[model samples]
Target: MSIRIPPASWAFRGFVLCFVFLSSFPGTILTQEVTLDSIRIFTTHDWFSIKPTVYFQCKGENKTVFPDVKNTNVSYSFKGEESWQPLTKLEGTKCKRCGIYEQDPLTHDTFDEWELCPSDFTAEGTYTHGREKEFNATFLCHGCSQVGPGSNKESGTEKEEERRGMRPAIVVLIVVLVLGVAAAGLVVGYKYWRKKKRQQEQARFLKLFEDGDEMEDELELQNTL
Candidate 1:
């Protein structure tokens, strides 16, 4: 004899089956969100200017793989700015590999070499001379889909320190220049004083010689008489 199942029991079973199927393939059932793991801002002190290099660390869902960074776009804005400005992708090698290879004793083959990966995206640009010192900046990747958590706040502090560092050097240069001018003036004044004293001595000696010559001429005339 076959047993009949209740309508409610059949519906519950069907719901359970659907739940199990979705749990087994969570990636398909759940939406994947792209996020930024971290961000770094590198400030380089160029002659009379500061260059800002922004690096972005993008991470996809565990089962999802990220595509080439060139396919994505990025932009940034200062703390008080109303709009976002595009960031130009920097060009060059962004990663490096350094490891030693060892031969397997039994297989007589080398092991897989390990490598170090860099940030997924990088952009280079210049900040206004004092703008970096004034406020923090934020970066967005993939057209504002991924954002950095105000990671560039340190940029302002670094810029202030850089400017502070220059102060001592400028002060030193000014001091040296003042000392040099004072030394030159002293040397010139000494030379002028010596020349004037020498001229006075020469004039006195000439006057004395003239007086003795006149006396000798007068004595000669007396002897002749």
Candidate 2:
């Protein structure tokens, strides 16, 4: 027996399947913004400058200047109220090439360069980078605190939960398909039984009519005798 499904219902089923498949995987990787909490300059890269302009930059991005951090051995702290509040955006624990530089008339001088990773930060949402005779600075990203090596367990748990959540949907889909097939089979079987019963009744009726005709012919022959 063949079951015919409507076109609109097929489209709806396709949409639901796609939604479930897409939802099973992780979502888009969003970048977290990092801000400068505090910074101290151990030494100045530019000489003959009473007050030098210092800034930090990630690769392929614009620089975030520290207005107060100009003199060496001076600790500059920020309340995260700077015009350029967030220094950079980091995706998960991935690292980016970033450095502190001193602005110059001709060329910018680099104080320190390193690969900055979100995993390097501590649970308190603080990360410090330092170079001898160059500079030392602390950065903050509250989002980073929830990431790192320790977050592996949490991530794994989340993934497991997602998998578990999908189980019931799949089971329901299977059960529905099975029940549809069973119902279709039952309808076809019922139709076939009804047709067979009607054919048997018609055959019995024709047999009874033929017997009556033979009996009538025999009685007429007796009468003629």
Candidate 3:
């Protein structure tokens, strides 16, 4: 008994796997009543995400609280920065202090910038690009939508801030991309070259076989003479 795969079927199998890998990545959870924040305010390291989540519940007088999605003016500042820079001035939605999606075009990762979360308890986590290290993050909320807790709206004199240094996040991303492209190029190039070499070798062998038969015939004729 022999096990064999047809050429077309093998190619089809490889295509399916590549599609799945590129479509979605691990550690990414999409769920209801959950907000994932990936903040990129820190220029020190290129690709870092400050992920935090808040869950809310009804309180006081046993009243059921409806989601009063309010203006979450997201601002970013680094440690020891003079003032925070306003990234998104204001935003409204059917969410109370929910972590929303914000993207950075330079490094191409969702930035965590949304502010003020409502919850019975808050949770936050931090990890480097590609699971290098795990660390806990601390975040405080301001100007929360007070359906049952406090404050409805407020504003203050904003400060100015500047980003600094090569984000560790950016460096890691560039390195990974370069390695991936190099690997794919090598694999594809090798397959193409091997196929051409096999064809050329077969042609050379055929020509030598024909020459050998002709030489045998000439030697027989000379002997007969």
- Note each model's CA RMSD in angstroms: 35.9, 12.7, 19.2
lDDT for every model? 0.36, 0.76, 0.34
lDDT of 1 by residue, 1-225 (tens): 957444456446555755664455312243311132322222322233322222222121111111211111232323322222222221121122222111222322211222212123233211221123222222233322111223222244664675576567557656755675566566667868998999999999999999999999999999999
The order of the candidates by TM-score, greatest first, is: 2, 1, 3
Tell me the spans in candidate 1 whose CA falls farther than 4 Å from its real position. 1-154
Candidate 1 lowest-lDDT run of ten:
61-70
Poorest lDDT segment (10 consecutive residues) of candidate 2: 21-30
User: Candidate 2: misplaced stretches above 4 Å?
Assistant: 1-27, 150-225
TM-score of each: 0.32, 0.55, 0.31
lDDT tens digits by residue: candidate 2, 1-225: 967554456456656765675454433244678899888888765556656789999988998888878677888888877898899888764567789998866556888888777777888889998888788889998877666545332344564676687678678767776675566667667878998999999999999999999999999999999
Which regions of candidate 3 deviate over 4 angstroms?
Answer: 1-115, 118-166
lDDT of 1: 0.36
Q: Pick the candidate with the highest lDDT.
A: 2
Q: Where's the lowest-lDDT run of ten residues in candidate 3?
A: 155-164
Clashes of each: 0, 0, 13
Superior candidate under TM-score, 1 versus 2? 2
